[model samples]
Target chain A: MPGWLLWLTGYLVVRVRCAAPERFLNLALAQGLYFWDARWMGEEWLEIRIRAGDFRRLRPAARQARARVRIRRRVGLPFWWRALRRRPGLLWGVVSVVAAVYVWSCFVWSVEVAAPEGWQRLGPGDILAWAEENSLRPPVLRANLDANRLAEKLMLDRQELAWAGIRLAGTRVIIEVVERRFPDTATSTGPAHLVAERDAVVEEVTVIAGQARVKPGDTVRRGQILIAGIMLPEEGDQAQPGQGFSRPRLVSARGRVWGRVWYEAVGQAPLVEEERVPTGNQVREIKVIVAGREINVKPLRGIPYASFQEERWWWAWPVWRGFSLPLAVEAGTYREVEVRRHGRSLEQALDAARARVTAYLRVQIPAPAEILEEQVQVLPATPGQVRVRVTWQVRQNIATVFPLK
Target chain B: MAQGEKSSGGSKLRRVESSLVELLDLPADVVFDLPRLTVIGNRRVVVQNHRGIVAYTPRQVRVGATGGEVEITGEELQLEAILSEEVVVRGRIARINLRLT
Candidate 1:
């Protein structure tokens, strides 16, 4: 018979309670009796089993023991009985049966795995049964299979994987992967020439590796080569071996090749300005998206000065039986500020436009770029409004292409 | 005694008694001076001396005859008139009599 069944039968036989438990004491002592494994039930409780035959003999022994014991009376029979019932030896038989079943059920019944780290190769479904066999809880699985950690582990283990992560949903585990993106370095090994992006006079040239095609103070058109990476055969004997044959060579050249880029910008301000004040307006919205769906974070407020900026992040992976799970997030913020526009002279407006163009060119050109020439014109568009147009000629060394390796 | 002289003596005595009656009846106390002590109410009052021959019971009395009254309701009233138009009442005085001047 099962040890729990034997213990239950014995517990039914050797039941003993003091006539009046003194001080309502419930004495529980540890003993050597094993009908079920206690470790599987954790350390929070204890369990023990006793045989029915041994219990029948112990019953008489308990009666004799109770005769020698003295207990107080006025505490009530129910209290004393409960106190006596709580004794460890008495409850151990019942606890053993319950604990035995619990341990048996938890041994290898169900399993869940979670890895928050990316999964470069392995997924949660790949190890669900294994986790169940190991007696790991859902939370334990999630922590162990964290997507970011999983991705790191995968990257470390597999050279092909760039990154990986694992996620958990219900009993399912998801694995996400990111392939390594390699840059194109083949262009650096081939013969190619550097060409100007715009038509401008070559102000200066600095040769780094390849031969120079254009010199300073030379006017070059758009698409014209500024530096030559391919070399032609020199004047020599005809019909020579590879020595006399012309071939394209891979090389590099860098220089301060200046060119003028023209840009026309116009800025306008009304002669009569209307000041904006807070109108005490506000709006709120609630949004939800199902799978494979998207929603705008916030709609336009329709205010004159209202504008929006957006940032996006994407999370996608395979979970259990499903594939292509995507999670996208967009955040938006709204603010109210005062906006004022005042009339400016044609010259001042033109200068502002020129400054804007200069800033843009500075970002595009890493080296020093100066505005060599500017043309400004102002026309009265309305009775109270004037339109200003400014064209700027910015000179900068903008290499069309750089060597890749 | 002679008969004619006796009759004349009798007439003279009668005339004196008639004169006293006439004077007493024609408001004889009207011109007699009586010192006036006027107690108006619990708040304020005025006292004065008067040269009036007539005095009335329960009648108001005023030095300037300003229609103010002071009632005499006490016994054994005696008034000592001062030369400065001031009056002082003596004895168990309950109230003073006042009238127009």
Candidate 2:
């Protein structure tokens, strides 16, 4: 219907310049040559379109009419094929790119796992491995992915998850999950008392659902009850005149209490230190490993150092940004280092020992405790080793429930 | 007297054909060999059932028909197409005249 379709079918459009294009038209019509889109330019020149096969037949008629016929342009499949043959690389590149894009689009490329809030108790890798075993992994055909059914199946299979949803976004599969929140039944109905978990001087105590047994500035020991679960009728209440004496009520105590606590840790450092330092002498080699066979891509045969330590890293060969081949490259480097012993002053040894003690004490104290003060003392030790003990005083909230069995 | 009777018989034959055409409700153009001219807004003319183009030029085009010759005079007159049965004449048509041959 359009000229481009005619071009595909191999039609030729020629511009005929003649003294009498009208005679040519009449002659062509009488012979039934079937030409169309006849446009007349001034000064006996015109353009017309005809089938590619008809051009030879028109030549004979053109001789009789004495019209000058020249092919101004050549179009259609035959010409296109001729031009394509000249530059084979372009045609091959176009075909390869189209095929690569189509093949890549049909398979899954990436998988993303979203574990919200408290669901991170399990690592992402464990969930990803489970998904892979369940047939939800990269390189899976996109057409075979049933998102809704897979989500329902995953939720049913995992008892610890509250809900699971799988969404297909482009070539990436995104998995979202919510872990089930198990109820802590002890704090609600159990007969529990708020107790101090460490030796501390209580700075503040607020009892919400229990009788306050220890007040602010009160020195308390470990396992001492700060809030009582059992409420007894006091003498003051018994002295009041009432219609009847109410019995003692027991409750599950919940409260907040802040206390200052102390922690101590001991660490040691040597006066003379022996360390291995890199000597900047290294040999690097890159090799490609496919299956089990290895081929040296970048060989380094000269190893100047007799003794060295080697480090190796492997990476899969990248085909595109999001695509990779099965082949992997292993990079290994051998570095030569020298062992050196260095002497330090007594003050420097003491400072290093204190640093080590402080580092040890940090692990002993519970998190969320603000350090109020730290005191370090040099302990009696041998000549080579400098030993020190560190004491750290910190303020922390000490509110732990002790359920009475 | 024979020649006079023959001329009257020719007139009677023409009348009978006309009456038969009207009774049968046939198109007049089909019954009679006629050339149809379609003029579009003084810009183009399509001539159907034409014998051939007698003369063609940028100023005018003469098309031969059965009864007469159709003449088209205009500026930049182009013989767009010419089939065995039809010819498309395109230009700024200034005048159209049929000269009986």
Candidate 3:
């Protein structure tokens, strides 16, 4: 018989001791009893196995053969069931553990959101928040989730997402997303003109598919069309066949226009600067911040110096890379300093103000624009401040496509 | 005189039955109610159509068959299973003896 069937039916090993154990075996066989693995253990003792139900039948045969039968071991389901019944707590523990594992497997444990490569605007947290709103959050029952429907809804709700795939792997829910691809230029191919993005003096105009509106040395204002999409018939052209004078044709304007643009900025600095020079005496204090409130480890007395500067360094608990808990330890250092007023010469003040203006201009100018001319002017100084203004003339492409409504 | 006549008649009947079995190409063990022993590489033995186990020991095992007893002598011989019609013995079998009683 199969081992599993034997286990299910249950069996017992019995040791029979008698002067003639063979007689006991014959008597058991005669009684229609089934047994196996009968081995002689020396000194009139024999060990054999019989089904749990047939164990009692061996008693009559043992009596007829004058043998003493004692159960050596119990094997299979009946003994296990009896043992489990005797200890209700252990049985309950085993049952509860199995049930807990089954229940836990029914819910999602983790949620992962995967985005397209090089996509930076959308993050996993944003997708998770959106999923939470859609009832696809973690710890949700897997039975209630429809992967196809959820994926369809995600793509429909998020315009940037071109495709979405949601699947469950064990206890984790994985959401893969692809972002929509957009063309470099506007999708519309209708007639459009290249207009000046900002006010500039036109230096060169090259038209590829439209009529040139402005020539070299022409001054143009913002929104003025550099190349016109609508082209009229040339003066020498004549009507053909029955057609009247050729009508104007519309085409998408494409070309580059180089212009000289001017950029200007102004900066001011105080003539007499107030400076702080450290006095070398400093004190340190430690503080702990829970949530948004801080508690000092030791109370600090009144300030020792009238003029002082305090710098604090905070060490927060890092729960994850690039993320931290609100709890933190703050170390503050206070250095005593003396405030003094420093008088600057007129040339020095002008230089300081000019430096500030140059820094401001660097941020305003585009990288590819060539600087043709730069002029800095020192405005009339106010009573306690120096004022300077800087201007830059740069050559760059100033054309931008403006679709015709 | 009656006993002699009966013995002779039984021998004639046996001869006829054996001839009939041979003529039909029937299995002798099934037709003649004989024991069939299957030995596997001197490691295991299966006895079919056996009466019962007569004795069992680590070095020897005796099983009763239809008309004789099968004696198995080996080292650490074990009765793996025993049923009404089959008995399986497993061990390093050294010898087997079939004795008619």
Candidate 3 chain B — worst ten consecutive residues by lDDT sum? Answer: B76-85
CAPRI-style grade of the A/B interface in model 1: incorrect
lDDT of 1 by residue, B1-101 (tens): 59989978967975885697687775433333334445545322335543321232112222322234344445443332212344333334554445544
Task: Kindly give the stretch of ten consecutive residues in candidate 3 chain A with the minimal lDDT sum.
Answer: A179-188
Write down the lDDT of every candidate, Cα atoms only.
Answer: 0.47, 0.80, 0.85
TM-scores of chain B, in order: 0.33, 0.76, 0.87
lDDT of 3 by residue, A1-405 (tens): 788999998999999898778778778878888778877787577889999999888888889889999999999998999999999999999999999999999999888998756354456877798899998877899999988789998876765666788888779999998865533334348889998978999998888989999999999999999998888788756635565768888988999899999989888889898899998998888889899899988557766888999976678787788777889898888899989999999888888888878766664555467889989898887799989888889898888888886
lDDT, model 3, position A188? 48
Please list the residue runs of candidate 2 whose C-alpha ends up more than 4 Å from where it truly belongs after superposition: A1-5, A85-91, A110-137, A154-405, B1-21, B28-101
Candidate 1 chain B, run of 10 with poorest lDDT: B52-61
- Candidate 2 vs 3: which has more DockQ: 3
DockQ score, prediction 1: 0.00
Q: Determine the backbone clash count of candidate 3.
A: 0
Model 2 Cα lDDT, one tens digit per residue, A111-218: 888987555345577668878889887899999998877888877666556788888776999988887664332354678888888899999898888899998999
